[model samples]
Target: MVQTTATRLKNRLRRTDGQLQGILKMVDEGRDCQDILTQLAAVRSSVERIMGVVVAENVKRCITDDQLDTDQQAQLEAALELVVKNH
Candidate 1:
């Protein structure tokens, strides 16, 4: 993955991790259901965004890899299959 994209994704994941911890604390403290669900949805959206960045970077790599041979193509295909199968 490109450095900038990777950094961005990592930062997003860190935020999501914090959000998850907050959710846990909320559950432990018996917070309102609506607020908890809202935070949960935000975390889910952040995760989805991270997935999108990863897939986009992989697609870019596939398109721009000049040394891609038959073996590499097959590997790319398998990787793409795994990505597509998620969610």
Candidate 2:
């Protein structure tokens, strides 16, 4: 079995996705508002962490290849900005 970083990230994201679906079902089932809100907040935090991992991975790849162009760097910054803004 070949274990890759991308595979790990993908697996983590899939688990998070399942958690999100369960949260949605809880909301639909009329669970307590406070509880649902807490779960939603957790989901947001998980997503942010995932995004950070992805960004770090990309930066690592770029650094390894010595190909971190200005445009790519700017795009990465913009993505970070969007994630922070939405959060």
Q: RMSD in angstroms, all models?
A: 6.3, 6.2
Per-residue lDDT over 2-87 for candidate 2, one digit per residue giving the tens place of the 0 to 100 score: 96978978887898898889888998899999898888888788788777767766765766334668788777767766654454
Which 10 consecutive positions of candidate 1 have the poorest summed lDDT?
78-87
Model 1 ranges off by over 4 Å: 1-3, 65-87
Clash pairs detected, candidate 2: none
Report lDDT (CA) for all predictions. Answer: 0.81, 0.77
User: Taking the tens digit of each residue's C-alpha lDDT, what string does model 1 give over 7-84?
Assistant: 887898899999999999999999999999999998887787678668867796768567688888779777776664
Residue 29 CA displacement from its true place in model 2, Å: 1.5
TM-score of 1: 0.67
